[model samples]
Target: MSNIIKTIDVTDSLENLKDVCDIENGRIAGKIFYDQAIYEQELEKIFARCWLFVAHESQIPNTGDYVTTTMGEDEVIVIRQKDGGIKVFLNACPHRGNKVCFAESGTTRGFICNYHGWSFNVQGNLVGQHESGIYEASDFDKAKWGLKEVAQVDSWKGLVFATFDPQAPTLQEYLGPMTWYLDALFDNQEGGTEFVGGCIRSTYDCNWKIAAENFVGDILHAGWTHDSAARAMLGGSVAKVSDFEESYSVNWNGHGYEFALDTVGNVAVLGESALNKYLHTIKPSVAERLGEFRSNMIGAVSSCTIFPNFSFLAGQNTVRVWQPRGPNKIELFTWVVVNKSAPQEIKEKWRKGAMMTFSPTGVFEMDDGENWEYCTKTAKGRVTAAQDLYIGLGMNSRASDTSLPGNVFKGQLNEANARAYYQQWFDHLNAKSWKELPNRNFGKQEAE
Candidate 1:
């Protein structure tokens, strides 16, 4: 409790912005979605400083395989090395800041700048400049002119993440207890997971946090927002409006997941029978490896967000990164992840299932985008921006001691995870350094 108090200051506006979220009271200021200053601050304090998902190892398996992505606002290249290590570098050329990698993804021995013919190797070392010895007299060195590299890059279960802050904790340490839940999906099978379907991208006229928070623990909206999609696809067997047995898990660094225990097979709207059969086939192995709790999550429809802006749906097998474009806009990149060792039939089914449910034109995806767009649009109004949004559901409920991780709330219909998320966001925005950040536990008494 003392640690929590030290991190928050509701009355302070030292940086020309009010405390947009009050985690202790479960109130979020609407202006957070529409304010430019807050958005810029988030880009600096959250996106630049925190670990962000770049690409999965499966996406770039071979040497020289690469993917272009954004780490905060800077474009970067995530490339594989000959030594079996991963490296990330600024996509811009050192000479004139022109982008060197133009393709979205492909295997190439090296990248050449189209603007001036400057070239860099797979390791990001400048190999060929347009003119050799042009600046030799000026102490120009190709060794010091390679593409700028990210301070840190690491992978966890094939998921690649990069950070600009060298002082930031390792990926595993930053992920903390969230890894327990992630492994349940990523490492459930013997061969682990791989990104299968080609990426689906779309833009939303809403703040990126809106989408991230929704995936984090907003099951409250599924019953209404996605009701039609569920009914149209599953004939009313999925996303029911009735109460269901569910649980919520939150981690120290703001990562969270919400899952329903009873709606396992019913959640996979595409080829439910086939998917269910497959789950049963793999259940024994998964249970033996990850224990009963995770094995039981095989077919359960669950949504999770990895802190800042990476999110995914477990049952649908869709993973996404919400790339922030501005205070009220985002370009969403999505992919379907599947068990690497799954039968071709199972992988195809999961791929098609993700396309049907969570793709850009997906029934559920469109509905969610509409809601978030309007939510952001409304917040632009002066009256709407000043109102406090209530997120107090299950705030006062007792924390359940569980073998899972973080603060485990007993039911899924709780805002406990969202509250913890905003608390972490607030703490990040206020902290001057990583060492100054507080160890926030949201008042949970038990320790893992």
Candidate 2:
């Protein structure tokens, strides 16, 4: 076996991706995020191989309840069975390779293969052979055949995850320093966050990475992108500060983000006065449940990603599952998350806030859709695809902030976050597995 993870030549189809850090001169000239070859490689090197976010534990609340999800392109069935624990299995039937269950989500005692009548239990066991008499004389061991289980599965803060690579680190370890930051959004409440409603599934005519990068890199666009909407609703929203542009830190493993303005509209689902009052009213309770800093950030909008595929706009309270449908097309699955323990009125307020700001009809979403669509159109051009893009902002970055979660940029508009994201993208693209990557890649604090 080759000791080093072999990498696709940076000069091949990815000829434009020249270096790990390239935010100087404000230039990011590459199609690495939207390339066909890179997308396929990600499915193998990153998606198929990494621990992917599958579903929230609450999605399967009762015995035999289940939901169909995806890890990269592989379909998985996550269910709550008799043992009162979550179980996940490849959605493919053991017989004839057909998908056993076709529903997007539901509760089930187990799945019966519609193709051949092979029944599998919630734990993915071949509990019943439809016709045992025909196979009684056969040498097949019933125990040997079960729905193919993902290599590894686990949860953190009630979020379900699974990995195709058996050797990848645990989800906590994989998340590294990001866990500390994520706790602000996911673990703040005593009961934690849960999906208020089912996810909204939509199709986008764009590359999956474009959506991923936008979450981390498009802080500059918020003010202008949603100017009309913000003006109509916010009427001089506080995020006008975000229009000034800023830079963010790059983290090891490429899980990073740019810190933008902290706005009331960005945080609590209620009005600014209501949100602020709630924080003050709940200060004692908030502190008792969550630390002071995390409590304060409850309503703050943060643009962040946990490397690989999971990306979220905390300010908007939207969790996006960017599932790739093809090289140039992607299925955008969005979920609204709210503190489960909050009062009915507060939950409803947050639901309204999330729907108006991030949903398919939200003004901010429509504003961004135009830009993303235009970019996608430009990427298809033979000339434009060959031309490189730029991401060099604050190239010789001169700031260090240990207290912050990841790398720190000099200003909010700096492209540091985008560079950090792409750097890790390159690292994953080049390395085959966690073990194959060099020790220094994760940096000291993040690696541990």
Candidate 3:
């Protein structure tokens, strides 16, 4: 056995790293959030290789419409093509590395670098440069000077994603069975979902993963964190739903969700008159299209995270991207999403409700930012960074059932989903290549 062990090559860099994350033991070192080296590695290995949500198709519905966003720390432009497809490119000029597009979002035939006269067409093809004679002495190929396009771009149910890795799996394959839960909000009607309000942006002094994990399955915090907001809106304390039937799910790639079996919208802070009436009227139609199980979830106020950074709240119809600024900061971009076919009043209600609950000035949003900021600030200490943070809640309590597609546990107030998230995080950090990623097994047994 000693000889056999000696023959095994152990040159992998991740193996040498200590205190990264121990998913099997359900412990995550605080340094992962405060360490500069780990943050840089995450940009290369995780963000660059993962399918990141860039924008909703509705945000750029017409040809030439575009939005500026980020993939990890790299600024990117997501644009609609004349061919009804979408394209994403690094938002930088190939000439002098200056930014090519400065506007947040707008419709344009092409982008012209403000720093220089170089121009790029809607397809990211280089069209012109100041005085063609400047490069006459050499072969300055315009075709090669086009914007640096992202390796892959795709959309699922109006949500667009892009990856810097050409070998990354298709968006549908990347999303996996999580689509079933996403459809609870996305596919509630025939027209699919559309972004209603303009995007809201805020900077938080917290690690990006802090927000991602919170959305994945942290319903436990809702009661305490948003207690004041809950009291003001509901005329009582945060409603106790401990007795309600709930479930949590985690996919192989770290996507996760937690939802309860509630008939009413749990997170809707808007007045109960118009929004509740509209949901009640549409409940049967939602049931018909998505089946009864998902229909029951339509207004249950679930939270979900699509692996690395995208997350949404179902009842509030708020979708956000937790854009990583660094190990200690995140830029959050939020938008209100509603069924495209919903009544105008219903859409407006969702828009206002999301603003009141999750926007930059939102009651709940302020509280969450405070907690995450303090957690991150305190982690900067040597003693705090050295401690092991426990995330073992409900570990090994998962059971298979027919109700959901991924690993489903019986209750919402558990950290099984968080553990699964860190498991995949460790996997991504350690993997030398995408091919080295574990297979799409949804259970702990299979993962082992």
- Which is the leading candidate under lDDT? 3
Top candidate when judged by TM-score against the true structure: 3
- Model 3 earns a TM-score of 0.94
Candidate 1, backbone clash total: 0
TM-score for all predictions?
0.93, 0.88, 0.94
Model 3 misplacement above 4 A: 1-18, 439-448
Query: Model 2, range 51-117, lDDT digits (tens) per residue?
Result: 7888888888898888888877878888886877776788887668889889988877778888778
Specify the poorest-scoring 10-residue window by lDDT in model 2: 1-10
On the 0 to 100 scale, the lDDT of residue 109 in model 2 is: 72
After superposition, candidate 1 runs with Cα above 4 Å error? 1-18, 237-242, 263-267, 440-448
How accurate locally, in lDDT, is each candidate?
0.80, 0.67, 0.81
**Which one wins by lDDT: 1 or 2?**
1
Error of 1 at 244 (Å): 3.0
Residue 84 local lDDT, model 3? 97
Query: For candidate 1, what is the lDDT?
Result: 0.80
User: Regarding lDDT, does 2 or 3 come out ahead?
Assistant: 3
Write candidate 3's Cα lDDT for 268-315 as tens digits: 565456777777788899889988888888878578999999999887
